[model samples]
Target: MQAIGLIETRGLTPALEALDAMCKAANVRMAGFKRVGSGLITVIVEGDVAAVTAAVDAGIAAYPKTGGQLVSSNVIPRPHADLARMLL
Candidate 1:
């Protein structure tokens, strides 16, 4: 993948909202989502570096409106190919 963005939240509502915002804010694809227990959820997206960065920011911005906790967020530019196989 050219880049990857991940956003973690405390509830499903914020996770889904953030995912939607991420996809809509940039030319990124919603690659996957995961539940890491304790009501924590993570949304993953992939795209170009700039797009991934913008998407991750948008996802974070959408979190406050959700009234759910924003756990963490990150963007990886030009990630290792192995990560795609493992994460994608």
Candidate 2:
């Protein structure tokens, strides 16, 4: 399985740092990070179901520490697969 996270929260660095920790904890492989727009970061990662769920869970948990904004994320099995293929 794969996961795609659209992080539209503040404090990009800290959020990313927390995300890194989460990914480590969840054992997820980070494909890369894409710039969606100003102050918006799209984090792309791939892993098993449990790992993806844990990553998203951790990201949501980290959102509170940032200040107020909630980090939104969505699972992208098919879309991510296509996107992955495009890159290849």
Per TM-score, the best of the predicted structures is 1
Model 2 per-residue lDDT at 3? 49
**What is the C-alpha lDDT profile of model 1 across 2-70, one tens digit per residue?**
999999999999999999999899999999988999999989999999999999999988789989999
Candidate 2 to truth, TM: 0.69
Work out the TM-score per prediction. Answer: 0.95, 0.69
The C-alpha lDDT values of all candidates are: 0.92, 0.62
Pairs that collide, model 1: none
Candidate 2, residue 63: CA error in Å? 2.0
Worst 10 residues of 1 by lDDT: 79-88
Q: Candidate 2: where is the Cα deviation over 4 Å?
A: 1-11, 78-80, 86-88
